[model samples]
Target: MGRVAGKKVFITGGAQGLGACFGHMLADEGAKVALTDINGEGAKKTAAAINEKHPGAAIAIAHDVTKKDQWESALGEAAEAMGGISVLINNAGIGTAGSIETESYENWRLTHEIDVDSIFIGTQLAMPYLKDNQPGSIINISSVAGLIADGMMLSYNSAKAAVWMMSKSIALHCARSGYDIRCNSVHPVFTRTPIVDPLIALGGGGEEGEKKLVRQIPLKRLGEPEDVGYCILYLASDESRFVTASEFKIDGGITAQ
Candidate 1:
């Protein structure tokens, strides 16, 4: 249960959905977590619940990951709150569905700002704090769409692909500098989160839309928040010390096709 004990984690989008799940999983494992999201009130609620369970192990911050100033401030505040930051989970993203032929520049820009730019900003700002820990981990929540392409999800595909490549670049830099700060990306196909609610609604609400999506997955089921949460736990822990610059696909074997 205490896999990440003593580590201090700062997670972006740590208010609800998969982000809140990550906060819960980490806090339960004895890590003092800083939960930051645009929804400050929701993030506070999430942190309060975790603190109730773990006692003084969490804090919530208002954050807009696209803004550099906010990134810097959040990192500083979180580092102080937990003594030093050891793990940074760049989990804030948006999935915009549109074809390259029809997607507007504005839609594409906003998609990149949240899905791609945030990872860049968070990694740059969190690097020094992670270096201070000697061995730290940065988990970027990419998508299986990063590995493969779909005609309708143009912006989402582009953004996640950028995250996949960026993680490798950061991993190489950390290794050459001998910091032992591991960087990697986690790619999930689809899961039970608000992000997929629209699809479910389109599928007539409930499991119908998910059924169509899962047909593409060999596992024959959509993912749970805890599915991704457990993976983050492994990477945040020293168990994955030697694993860096790689991509972990939680796509229910979709990539196997």
Candidate 2:
């Protein structure tokens, strides 16, 4: 049997990038997947592709993770579509690069709302369904920037750091309340995603710049979406029943060095 057989997973920002990768991977493992994104058309397109591959296994909804009402609506829809939500992946976020002094208050607010507040909304909205499931997982996507300092990504770093702490807090609350839900965050270094394409373009995309970045890693390679997807799968599955309140670093020794 697959790791997530018969499981129901709800993922935010699932139309593209790592979120899309997660949806595909989970559906392949026999899970019923519900994906939501701000782009309703993109979500529909992704759902179509997933359904074509997995056949009646996935659904998509439009959701703005920062909005509590949207979270509630999305959760209700997901539960209705997939039986119940056993896993929630808070994957919607944006990146900003600028020194603290140079970063505007508007940028900071946007970063925090998308990266940090989304986690709060997703986790809180999923709580009712998760409570009923008795052994659910809430995985928040943090970043290596969250764990370590990076130049010119002040707002991004701050928001991700908050996500890391929020995961821990929710895990503690669940444990104390005797809820069977588990919460954890995954911190990954530069993974190739649509969000990073612009940065790569600016740096001269190809082996030249790729080699430069890879050299910083002991593994000598950047992470793939599936690399993080598999890590999330393990955490979402029963194999990790005893694990909670942890940070899984998929940074290829970036943080270790």
Q: CA lDDT, every prediction?
A: 0.92, 0.89
Which is the leading candidate under TM-score?
1
**Clashes in each model (backbone N, CA, C under 3 Å)?**
0, 1
The alpha-carbon lDDT assigned to residue 40 of candidate 1 equals: 97
Can you write out model 2's per-residue Cα lDDT over 79-152, one digit (the tens) per residue?
A: 99888999999999998888977999999999999999878777877899999876899999999999998778
Task: Identify the leading candidate in terms of lDDT.
Answer: 1
Q: What's the lDDT for residue 65 in model 1?
A: 92
Candidate 1 lDDT, 152-228, residue by residue in tens: 99999999999999999999998998888999999998899999988777777767777887788899999999999
Relative to the true structure, candidate 2 reaches a TM of 0.97
Segments of candidate 2 deviating more than 4 angstroms: none
